[model samples]
Target: MKKLFTSYLDTFKGLSKEIWWLALITLVNRAGAMVIPFLSLYLRDDLGFSLSSVGWVMTCFGFGSLFGSWLGGILSDKLGYYKTILLSLIATGIGFLGLQFITSFWAVCLGFFALITVADMSRPAFFVALSAYSKPENKTRSLTLIRLAINLGFSAGPALGGIIIASIGYYGLFLADGITCILAGFLLIQTLNPKKAKEVDQEQLVENPLAPHKDGLYVIFLIALALFGVVFVQYFSTVPVYYKEVRLLTESQIGLLLGMNGLMIFVFEMPLIAYMERRGWNLIGNVIGGLLLTGLSFLFFYIEGWPGVLVLGMATATLGEMVAFPFGNAFALRRAKLGRQGAYMGLYSMSFSLAHIFGHNSGMQLVNSLGYNLTWAIMGLITLLALALLFYVKRRANTLKI
Candidate 1:
């Protein structure tokens, strides 16, 4: 245990202050995501929203993010990463506070939209900062650490939210979450300021580095990644509804399940990425496998009555996420051409937004019309298609030498 602890510390030793600061920002921002883990329940139970209504609310949030991501990237390039990040944090914090005052469905939806927009806007800036910070050799590990921190925050956030929501309810959760965002923004303000790194010898060897690629590769990757976003969006939209409406789980139980996924991510993601890197597996293969694992895990919903099955499913899917996401990010960052890091990251962020808009709206419709079981089953099938797409993408990347 001590050895492992020391090794983990060693990983951070040479990491840039920018990576640490951004990651710390991620930690604080994600802590507020606890409110989101059970947002469907809050909408349905506390706000008296229907599934369709919840879908629209999520759609608004997604729509906001679509623009937010692009704007963040553009602004990062023009206004600087530090300014963009700080502005986004302020917007997101204000939005979270607005959530406390929502009484009607429209108000809630709008508030969510505003909050997600700001949070998402912060993403491109942070991504650009991270890419600018690390050496190619340590890049993957650095991202893994960032992810671990985010997951660690995620694990604790929902657990804390669960306890708070169970006792004081959603109002308290929203207020506390907002305050946390404010604190994060303040910390980031103190620590991070972007200063460009001079090109090193190793940077020259890497072809078409984040210098800005015009080959349209970024667009293609963005499209494929949006499909991934579609699959992931189910976590907030369909999964919560399923746990509640179909399986009859309580809020606390749902929180536990969501937190369990984060726990697995925190525990296993970095080591797994390291192991795969050691084996010389292509980054694309890890992404494909991750998508497959995530898709297949949905099959466990067939055993939802057992409760533990859901826990096991989270663990399985989380393992896939651990493997796929970090590698995919590293690959994408490395492939981005010079000076286009913000644009590429913005496109990447947009994929998640597109997915949320498409996935939630469609999943909610399917659930209302077809039923939760069938909806999940169909979603699994869609994920398989995404995996197949990843396969094609991998082959294409190899051919293009991207």
Candidate 2:
């Protein structure tokens, strides 16, 4: 028994110190991820935003995220990963402080847009840092490690956010969230210190955006990914709001239901992925299957007559999330040569960034106009279209030969 435990531990043993530090930073920052999970709810419950307005207002975050994704990649390459991470964190912390004071709708929307843009710049820079420290073969696992850290933190954030709002109000949550970001950035900077200064001050800095490579696999994947993202992202945006409105679940209940994704991922994903790889699981197959399951997950909302429909639906969605993301990151990086990782990671982040605009806005609009089940059914269909695209790309997956 002890040998088995030790062996499992060994699987995570060899990587870089940098990878571990990045995961630590992820844990600290994401532990305070109290804002976004509650953003839609805040708009609706506090400011009395109609569902349509909620959707449109959330569009600001998406637009900001799009620019943030681009900037994260670019700055990580040009200015260095450390500086990019530092600037993103400290700047976003200020944004959150600004958010605490906004009361009106347009003001709230603009605040969210600006805040998300600044905060999201951390994503690709974090990815670039991960790739720098990961061995080629372990890249997917490396990505999964940071994601695991994120999930572990998320497992706490929603539940904690629920408590904070109950005790201290949304204002407290925002201030807490802002403080953690600054703290995480500070800790990360101090830990890496002068050694991390290499990217900016040394030979590794990219002076120009590298041109896109041949065969356009990167571009194709990005387009297909955006489609899948439009479906996948509903868990964060539409799910809580829908359940709260229609199902009449309380904030704590909604948080737990949402946080279930985190708990399951934290416990199960690494071991499960390890087992699958040993059995020769195809990455693209997982991607396609995950997308299919994501669509199907929404169908549970139709089965409201059953007791566990919502929980079951969320369970299915979490599984889809687990399989898709790390593999997607891996696929994105698989085609890139050594130095261009920042560019690839940046563009990959952009896929979801763009999806946020389409998904949140269209999803809430559908909910307001067409109703939840119909909106979900439409999303399921879109997922199938995305699956078809992935299937096409899978056949030529090896063509990326970079």
Name every residue pair that clashes in candidate 1.
210-337, 210-338, 211-337, 211-338, 211-339, 212-337, 212-338, 213-337
Which candidate wins on lDDT? 2
**Cα lDDT over the full model 1:** 0.78
- Tens digits of per-residue lDDT for model 1 on 171-201? 8887877888888888876776434333221
Residues 1-402 of candidate 2: C-alpha lDDT, one tens digit per residue: 999777677667666777777888889889898888988898888888988888988788899899999889889889877889989989987788778899888898888888998998988888877767777767777788888999988989998998888887889878988898999889888775546533221124345535544437667877889999999778878888887888888888888887888999987788766766667676777888777878888888888667589889888988988888778777777654533766777888888998998899999999888888889889988988888888878877746533
Best by TM-score: 2
Question: Any runs in candidate 1 off by more than 4 Å, and if so which?
Answer: 1-13, 194-214
lDDT of each: 0.78, 0.81
TM-score of 2: 0.93
